[model samples]
Target: MLKLHFAPNSRAQRSLWLLEELGLPYELNRMEFNPKDLKSDEHKARHPLGRIPVLDDGDVSIFESGAIAEYILERHKNGGLKPAVDDPLYPEYLQWFHYCEGMVMPPVNTIVVHTLLLPPERQDETVRGQAQRLLTRALAPVNEAMEGREYILGDFSAVDTMLGHAIYMSNRLGCVTDEMTNLKAYVSRLETRPAFQKAMSA
Candidate 1:
């Protein structure tokens, strides 16, 4: 059986959602989202950075949600979540799958650090504002792409699981503004997914 080291309200939720979507039986090693729990030697052994969403499958251990999601799909024959390499959509799939972490999450994480992670006195509103602007700019293309599309690739795929988390995080941080109607609608569609709901509850 697969085993996952998870923490609530962390990127690990993406892995959990993937597992649920795949209906794969796995062990959940839930941990606290704090240094005492994540920074311990035991946890560090699984991930040098002590990050959540570390997956253990027999002798194979891996970290990072994007890699984990791909690992799961590759092992499970894409689990109907990935486009076949021969298919033309495969290239686009790969782009959007990585885009969540590469383009969107940078600013989203910046906002998180400046707004939630940093101490109140140390938190910089200026930094947060800049991140908000960057986030808006980063999502503009996505908003445009979302026009007349329900999902990133016009079908719910693993990419949605990854991007959904970033969008959800941005929304929670108030970085998702009212003018982002397309994104707001996209969020609504993602929120209605049972897999997304189950993951969020975790």
Candidate 2:
């Protein structure tokens, strides 16, 4: 059986959302967001970094949400989250899928670390402001891309699953706002998905 080691509110939610979207039966090993919980010797065996959303498939183990999503999609023949290589949009789909972490999350993570995770003594106002601006700049193209488009590729794909989570966190951190009406609508659309709801609560 597929066993997913997850932590609520972490990037692990991405994997959980994907699993729910695919209607796959798997074990959810929910964990707390703390070193004592994830940084244990046992957990480290699965992920050297002890990150959440590590998928254990019998003898194989995988970490990284994007990798996990691809792993699951490649295994499920009925999974239509990715585009076929023959499809013209396949290249664009691949671009957006990886763009989630490559472009979007770094600044969002910086803001999150500065505003919420870091202790007051360690938090830097300068870093927070810089992250906010960087995040805004990074999101500018996404807003432009969403103009008159439903999804990144004119239809729902796994890229949405990856990008949606970043938008969700960005919204929470005020990185997304009403001025970006298209992005706001996009986030709202993602929020209403039943699988997304399940992952949010899971």
Q: What lDDT, from 0 to 1, does candidate 2 have?
A: 0.87
Task: Write the residue-wise lDDT of candidate 2 on 1-202 in tens digits.
Answer: 8899998888999998988888889999988888997999989988888888899888888899998999999875445788898999998888878878988999999998998899999999999999899888888888888899887777888888888788888998998967999999998888889999998888
38 Cα displacement, candidate 1 (Å): 0.6
Candidate 1 weakest lDDT stretch, 10 residues? 75-84
Candidate 2: where is the Cα deviation over 4 Å? Answer: none
The backbone clash count of each candidate, in order, is: 0, 0
> Could you give candidate 1's per-residue lDDT for residues 1-202 as a string of tens digits?
9999999889999999988887889999999999999999999999998998899999899999999998999886554788888878788888878888898899988888887789999999898888899998888888887789888888888888898778888888887889989889999888888888988887
The per-model lDDT (C-alpha) reads 0.87, 0.87
lDDT of 1 at 151: 87
